[model samples]
Target: MLRFDPKGPRKNDLSSWRPDVVQIWSIGEFRANWATASDTRVGYTAGGAIAFLDVTDGTLLRSSIIESNSAATGGGILCEGSSPHIVGCEIARNGAGFGAGIRSEGGAPLIQDCSIVSNQGVVYSAEGAGGGIASGSGGLVVSRCIIADNYGADTGGGIFLWPESRAHIVQCLITGNDTCWCGTFGSGGGIMCHSDFATITNSTIADNSACISGDGIEISGSPTITNCVVWNRIYVRRGNPRITYTLTKHPRSGEGNIVADPRFRGGGDYRLQALECGGPGISPAIDAGHPGVEDADLSCDWGLGGSRSDMGAFGGDGAGIRCNPCIQVFGIPEMVEYGDVLNPVILATNLGTFDALVAVVTGPIDTTIPLYRGPPIDVAPGDSVVLERELRIVPSIPAGLYRCDVDATLRGEFVSRGVFETILQDD
Candidate 1:
């Protein structure tokens, strides 16, 4: 864990941090005021006096920022005048007027794999925005992150966007944010957008509350929302927010939009699952996303490997796809004659946080051979699946290097694909 004392005895600058020459590191904790004596002073300004860390440029990776306090802006970290990259960081329990967790003022910032939670925004004199994060005219992009349980006094309990700014949020979970102090004008318990352009895709917004309205989101300008699951309400005060391919609790009219429960797992776990396996399963949301839609910020493949994106934060991995399954295919035949049968063996091991569903292997070599239809084979956590399936070769099949493209749909629609090579020799 690399700790940076912003108010070091010698200096208060980060000149010693060289992003280019430093080796790639994953810091566990990045406490700024761990060694400094607590100051009871009242006017602790932007980014806090001792706990603030201004990341004007470069990249921050795999770090957690906690217990920061600021009376002005950005309680934990401030990104101003320069672009920076933040990945896999936790910004929590911070307090500020504008942004309790992070403030992107004049430059773009890329935030991914992070959690901004339990932050507080106080509206003393000026209007408080963004309990978790605030973005100014400079655009920002957020992906694969969880922004939850933040509280704001005025607007945007989760995130706020300044006028003319732009933001792209993908595959994120925004939930449990509350805007309490704005008596009749509180907006966007999850997000408030006053920007010209904004886009939210393949994300989930749930359980947010506002004192006035717009419990899920409030938009002043036109924005595009696609393939998202909104469990609450939304308010568009000015321009229209074009929504498409979404599942919402209240019926919203748009292309491919449906009023259906996204079936997120309860008890504080919001991951989507299938109905057959219990819990409010998102059977309707799987493979129901916008076709050809891809989240550029997502590092891994989404859905059943068909280039189709899922609706919510969990994507199309189905119920138990969150459990990373270690699957291996072997014993593929090198050569086979027409009218011959080929047997392939598949071994799968579950190595993730939850139990994986039954393994079903389907293979139709080039859509010519009949597919092997099978039943669900449950693979418990830390257990393995030893599967053997047979494929019959038709005499009408041509001679060539035929590849058996195998697809395993675990749980429900969570698909894992593999290829087995075999040469079809003419007999």
Candidate 2:
């Protein structure tokens, strides 16, 4: 049980350096440089617990575990010249003035099986580099980790790779990330690479979205992308597949890949499947890519079963995002229109480990059930419920907001009552 704040800095009278626990409360901006300032030998395991602390240390840092902050700029961390590592940490609500959640500067991070989500970047600025992890100038690696739900005003919602940097991602997932004002400046919903090199094997970057440029995997520098599944890319450069080049050691043929939809079993807890609207198919990512970098991956799987080198993240065979637990089910409309269905769209997300089969019913009969005959049912872990009823514009149907209650069921267990509201429109 921990608490946090993004308004300012943590308490001045900090606690003694605990090798097991460190919960900081960062209101605005505060620094947590973890290098022993003097000659000491305290083996503080990097994955203990660091909750609620934000600041711009050296350049690159990782305030992992039990840690929480709404920091911007070199967000949750900025890997300066050292290897600021964070294991089993949580970075939520934080954004970047420049580089959000994480600014992976020059070094080799030891991030194993962690979660980085919700962090974001604002406006169009080079400052907010990576909404999740900004990789730059060196050997930065992320393995068996999940980086999702982050936001970026410009490029790299999940990761922004600067020039001259390199990454070795394995069995990881980067999805559901979004860019500000879609289709504007700074693209790449999942990853935005300018002039660098990265080898993403057995990883997943799906359902990620952007406005103008690359949606799944955006590459500019001569990168070696092998056996990875890239699906739902908005507007990719047709016939200009140089960005997604393959990994050729000898005659490096720029970028390379299978450019196909691996057809994941379940995208994740969100249950949002891939729908091929104007572009490619659901799986089979249209172009099998050039024959040159075919042998790049050891997993051979294009978008079907697992092979040697994977397509995108999970080698075309991996689990997607699970249901969110800490989601609050409530709503309050800002505007309403005629015929425009009026009802409460209470989205109760379960971010906890277990499923929250919560039931949110109406208080009185003020608002009708099944608004507009739409789908208004129960939502699971990472699900949503929308209740609406058609409007007939009766002789005199007042136009105002109505209220409701929010209840919950944790594994058939019911909780107290909560409150929410909605609005009604007239003809």
Candidate 3:
């Protein structure tokens, strides 16, 4: 453990030798007050923690930075004219007047697979922005990250893009962020974009709240959003954004845009529900993304048997997880007579890495009338199993077109569903 006193000089010289690479590994913790003013390249590996660091150029991987406080910008990381590759790290509970988690002034920075959460941007003489990140004149790429539960005093609870900055956000989740100040000055709870050009794709921005407007995103300059999900409001004060194949609460004028509930798996699981996977219903966001994109599983629509991609962070090439036990129903009769016994077959394939315990249940759509229930079957990764069930149609039942549903349960929870329509006639 290394601790630096707050009373130390605001700028300290840690080392004089300009090494080609400085690797800090296996350290327990580092509590520093001021930023490291070195142009030398640095890398912090796993098993180490940093309270704060001023990064000029470096790569930080699998580290933790938490609870640092700064009176100025970037309580956790201040990047000045430096392009650092920060990946697989957790940055949380930091405070600063601007960019509590990270502040990039110039140069292109790549932040990937990180969690920026619970940071606060304090008001500094009416100047506060970017609770999670602030990009001031730079090209920043944030990919496959979760930025959540951050607070901004003025605007941009999750991220702020200053003028002349360009940010490319892909396959990220920004949620539960807030922006407020004296109940009158807040905006852009998820993202406040004033940059020259910003492009957001395959991301999920939801449950953000602002004091004034733009609970999901507030745009001042031209930005392009595609194949994303915005559960909250998006207010454009200036400039027009090209939004396409996106899902929003309110309908926006764009190609493939839809207004519907994303039906996210509850309890912080942002994955869209597929009834075949034991969800109560299918989410409209499933398979409703850009046609050109593909998920990590090489499936166009999150591997749920869709031609197009999904519209959320779980879609695209950087999706977090693969679908387990992708069940498909087949051999269901299209027409049947009353009092006839029918046989249906279903195939369950394990697409995930681990083995899965699965069961099969067949019944009428939205009913508890289980026609057949199979015993638990163990499925290994990349393996498939076929199950058959006999379903008898009662003669006393009314003659009509009915939907027979096959639900696959994983560890007692339904995760997938398959349905086929059958015309039942009394003959």
Give the best candidate by lDDT. 3
Minimum summed lDDT over a 10-residue window in model 3 is located at 39-48
Better of 1 and 3 by TM-score: 3
lDDT of 3 by residue, 20-125 (tens): 3423322223333433323112232100122223333233334544445453677676665554556666778777778888877665566767899998888965
Give the C-alpha lDDT of model 1: 0.63
RMSD of each: 15.8, 22.1, 18.8
Candidates 2 and 3: which is better by lDDT? 3
- Displacement of residue 166 (Cα, Å) in model 3 is 1.0
Candidate 2 lDDT tens digits, 304-403: 2223323444333222122233222211233344554322223233322222333343422354322122222233342222221122324344666655
Stretches off by above 4 angstroms in model 1 are 1-15, 19-44, 49-57, 182-185, 275-282, 294-307, 316-427
Better of 1 and 2 by TM-score: 1
Give the alpha-carbon lDDT of every model: 0.63, 0.46, 0.67
Better of 1 and 2 by lDDT: 1
In Å, residue 356's CA in model 2 sits off its true spot by: 50
Ranking of candidates on TM-score, top first: 3, 1, 2
